[model samples]
Target chain A: MKKESISRIMSGIDDEYIKEAAAPVKKSGNIRRYITVAACIAVVIIAGIILSQADIISPSHFSSEGTTANESGGGDKKFPETATEGTAEAPLDSFITPGEEIDTELAIESVTRPKWEDMIIPMRYGEITLGEITYSSQCTEISSENILSKLGEAKMQGYDIYTDTYYTVTGEAYSVKSISTECAVAVRIDNGEEYFIYVNSWYEPEDLGDFISDLDLKNTVLFRKAFIDEYKHSDTASEHSQRVYADFDDKVIWDMLEDCLSAENTEYNHPYDRIGIETDMPLLGYKNISFCITPDGYIITNILNTQKCFFVGEQKFREFDEYLKNNVPYKEYNTVYELNPDGTIPGKGEDGQSTPGFNPDAPVQISPPYDPSQEEAMSNTQQSSSPEIPQDFIIEETTRTE
Target chain B: MDDSKIITLFFERSQNAVNELSEKYGRLCLQISVNILKNISDSEECVNDAYLALWNNIPPEVPDDLKTYLIKVVRNISLKRYHANTAVKRNSFYDAALSELEEVLTADVSSENEVLFKELSEKINTFLGGLSRENRTFFVCRYYYGDSIKAIAEKTGNTPHLVSVRLMRTREKLKEYLRKEELI
Candidate 1:
């Protein structure tokens, strides 16, 4: 078809559309712009304070036992032991300096590790079998098959379910955070005993890997290596050998929660939204702990509260997907909790110290009460509102039954 | 003045109706013409012709929306002028918008078939109704109004790159829709 015919046809579209498009674009006033800037600054400052309190930047946090390879009892792969005389290793340097005294302590102090390495939490490995997989939204259960079918129908009918005003998924168990045209997000949430797996069969594993990497799981969660021998005796031995698992440090998780809370002050929603997992592994300490990428290419998780809905754009999504596809930790791991021999968390006792000779298959304890101070902080952040702030997708507490 | 008042003036045969219409939507009308014709003199002439058409037509045919009716008149007149100018030497600006739409509307729509034209327009409108508010606005401003990427970016409060990328994606969706409808 000639281009002019198409243009002429476009001219005949509904008049309401033409009027709407022709309407003057609203411009923010100077005062409102200043307030937005001020609000963004306040959010950043508050985030910095909360993260500082959690010791996210301090290298001292990594110095704790079980964090380092040598301290964790790595035999052959252990770091080189320091000799009293700085012997053979320093022969070339020693000859160059001859009789000059070397400031060994200063030299050691000068060397530093990358900040992200310090963020990695060391963890032990194990597995937990999941029970039923349920799909839900707005605190009510929905047919997963039905939603998937409708999504396909919508695409075939030349309409988008993601853009549909009423098409929203918000819940605790397996909330559909993002419904992108290309893929969907299905996350697993364990309810203390059995796991409720919400698997999105349409989800591209490559995208899932990317979404998990975007969460920066390796930095925030403890990497654990499972005892392949133990799995060898069990029916799921091959599964264990093929997959890796990690336990997240609640401190980092809380930092992210606070970050999302502070996000309310910003005018525009930041593309990199935080994803929280909702798993109640006693080892996980918290009842909720997970995150997933939405079908709309946004990574959103409401593991903590439905009030935490945020969006990242397609470019950022693609970048994260590419990263996860390339990274080994994200590609190889399944994000399952590593259980101790007695089915208890190895370091779940007082001050994170292990309790010896625990009972196996004992009922897992529920998470402690939500910290009142944190709750108050979240409430305070949620209450802050401005006309300039567009997205206030705080799922009402009433909608969340659990 | 309200559209009703403007129409009442037109019905009463008052010349002030044209003046009121010009005052209310002159800039927008001129801009739409400029987008298509890309010539200030020709755009102004076409807008004036549209105002005369509105004045002559309003007494016999009272439009539900005066601004929308006036805009359509101006846009149609401007497009005619653009087509005429293209016969000699093409106006790249409006041609860019036409080419964009041409990507999806590949059906052989004969000019003689008014029914086919109306059908295509209705199908496009239905497709638009299903889009998100932002996507619909972006598509209309780009295709219908012949807006430049920078202009669309400014209107939507987004970067030019973002606006361009979104338009490209929307076009892809439109292509898919047309294929399903057997229009292309």
Candidate 2:
């Protein structure tokens, strides 16, 4: 990124967005109550101070009249005296633990998920047989409608489904496992073999997307193949592919592709090839080649090949996925305000442009634009006012444009 | 600028108040946000949000120190954003810092944040007042201004590591004071 672009990103903010995101500071009743309570305390403290100074009330007076006044006076009088001592010299030991130290060098460790519990199942491509398929008596036949219905159910339960491609094949099928929400069915055609198939209706698509997206396909080939195998069962494979392609959209798929291909576009002669696009593909000539609508119209994915890219390794991809998993979409509002170099809002001068380094709201005028003689005089005065003035102040004004 | 005049303008709720605040404290707020958020876009957003928050707040709440007020606003907003973005999957620096604070002030809903913040402000004020001119500047540079220890030491003619040690000790003292007050 250009330095100016980075600076702009750093400084460019939208005011309107902030205004919208900000919770309107309602006149907090609690704050008002606090102020009232503080006022009351202040009044009490001031009164006590005044009375003490006037010698109208003193500790000695309380000691002298104690027993007689204490007995005759109501419980309130006795309470205040006791509370006064209690309030005075309140023990600090209770609040401060000596062991509590702020380590200036303290670096917080990154959070991690439990290995076994959070691990994504690996995908494997291997041959399997029909007789080896353990059919759950309850295991239902696989079909496009069945898969779509299951996916729809998962979506209702907050899952997101993104199908990459679908190819069909007939084989002996096996029922591997069954859970409450869905069952895992393994398909095998030849003898003494098994092919894994994941069937889970309870898998929320949004969560599944996160889970699947995070998976390193090379390492989790078995798991990936399982999904691919099930997807192939549908007759409308082309239609489904189109839908998946459309669903991924340009932005989302590009972001995913960016994660997948850490190589910067600038680094390669053809970065599109790394992102699974055909190198000879006619679409490569565009300044920005974005992906949407697959061959079928089921889903969309974005594809972005940026000039500036950070090479995200496997670990980084995992970290990024973890970040996405934890973070939810938050409302963002932004508004732009012009700023002076010193970082204050800019206001128009007599000339209509903002007066450089001037703040209209400033109570005291800062260093005014200098006439040469006045500048010399101010410097002499500054020297007299503070002998600790730095040497930089004495430099000649060669750079001064005014 | 005259502090009183600035305070007066802020009370008046003039557009100039926003202008002056952004001019005087915009970089400071940006620096605070950047330090916390680490992402330029996010930090920039936080700074803008802080300015708006100050604009809304100053009329009703006349701050004694405008710089501190702006910094606090930026810090709070950036930290909130940080939490929202990273709370579920990954533990964030904000969470760690807050958890550390929770140790000082028990994390009871009633007595935690508001009471601790008020107490912290008081303690910081008292601490700043008690420091020698040089030490006060050093403390401000390291903590309030978030300058590095080496930079602070070089600016003040102290050793780099000495600056670090002094900051560490000061933080411990402040923590102790908070604990002693039973406000932690």
Candidate 3:
């Protein structure tokens, strides 16, 4: 057979294999929540950054590389064409026009803490610190119908299982799989009563850190980390869970977030399609934002409870994983599993009654002493619920043009 | 819109099915075309043609996965265009994938060998079935989808070098398997 026929022959492979190849691996519940919530924050910040950094488009870029829709046969136009040229030192707002600058700030500030009553906690990451429940209800819309309309022309509609929400998806859903093509998907969710829209795009996705850095929310933002591990009972072989909670230094969190956001799109398609319920629970956590650098090299955040996910490439995933493994300090709580395997220290059962699984005579596993402070913080913190959408984040057509 | 809804529209003879299908999968279809044709105008035209083909075919034939079906059609159309343009134009990405297969199945065959094509396809499927999930995904993504090594690496969360090495090994295995089956 001719070599060219091989392509055709390969197409007849089992449909199951094809489907398996196309679908991304399912993520765990906590990470899924992080992606959903954090996606909303990413949407607001990205849209705001796009507006503030609009001036990153130096006139020189327009003169040299700019092509109009008509010129490019109506192909997609990439935004912030000149953002790469901006140095880390230059704040993103520096690019804005004075009139537009004030307007953009007003839009952003409207979403900050305590202003709107239906305050949406865009991200509450960990159980340890309950990281600052940064509040915003600026993007919420009353009519479910209006939410779908805001997405421009939705080419497709999908359901997000985690939020129990339906979405109108605009843009190329498949481009998330391609590395060369710039991907942009505007996902609008209507939870039957209230709705919010977020645009998830990878236009120089690597610049997310720069955008976050520009906002300089690091100092004000609180981050919490949770390390969860599963241990096997030495005597009974029954598995139990252990959690270690710690706070991330704001700078470290910010730096890690930047590194993750700055990661180039690695042509991975982890299906930020409508968020789905993730069941496998991993033990590690980055911030109360429920941020997880998934093993498959994607960063997920449930900050806005949107369950939005994006690819951060493998290198970034490894770096984040390594940082969590080596640098972060954890005070383990619920250390009964670490004691003797000879049934001396009784294992806790589902009913909270001690099961006979511990062995005092067997080799003992040691863990760091439990810190009362971690438990105290967990008790003192009141977990925030999912927030309503921010109000002004919906970009006007003119805003994008400007 | 979901594939089932789109298919229902197609079954009902609604023109909106084409719009919904194009809206949802058009960008990806266009990307597939662009990868092979290497011309935006040509790619656009090829994708439009594929859409028309999809519209015509869906009523008579229901697809289990519209996205995959549409992609196969798009790739076929683009490959046809690529072959037609081979005299003057070259697409390194598409050619590289084709060349790898060419190296493995270098023996030329005529019309008489057409009967063996089905058996060869089945043998290949059996070979793929024996592979681990990761290796199977890597093979399909590379040879079947015509994805570049870098693209596969990014998608699979592996370095390009690792993807390339794995694909080479897989291809070697395929050659050996085919030889054992006496199909090549």
The two-chain DockQ for each candidate, comma-separated, is 0.37, 0.01, 0.18
Give one digit per residue, the lDDT tens place, for model 3 in A196-257.
32322212222343233322334323444545554444552234444443543446545656
lDDT of 3 by residue, B1-184 (tens): 8899999999998989889988998887876677666688998988999988988897899998887888888888887787678652365566678778886774455535666666777887888776656667878777766677887777777657656756776787688778887766
Q: How close is each model in CA RMSD to the real structure?
A: 21.6, 38.6, 23.3
* Model 2 C-alpha lDDT per residue in residues A293-323, reported as the tens digit of each score: 1211112222112222223344534443343
How are the candidates ranked when ordered by TM-score, highest leading?
Answer: 1, 3, 2
Interface RMSD of 3: 8.0
TM-score-wise, the better of 2 and 3 is: 3
Looking at model 1, give its docking quality level: acceptable
Considering every candidate listed, which one attains the maximal DockQ? 1
Error of 1 at B59 (Å): 0.8
Per-residue lDDT of B15 in model 1: 88
Q: For model 1 chain A, where is the 10-residue window of minimal lDDT?
A: A152-161
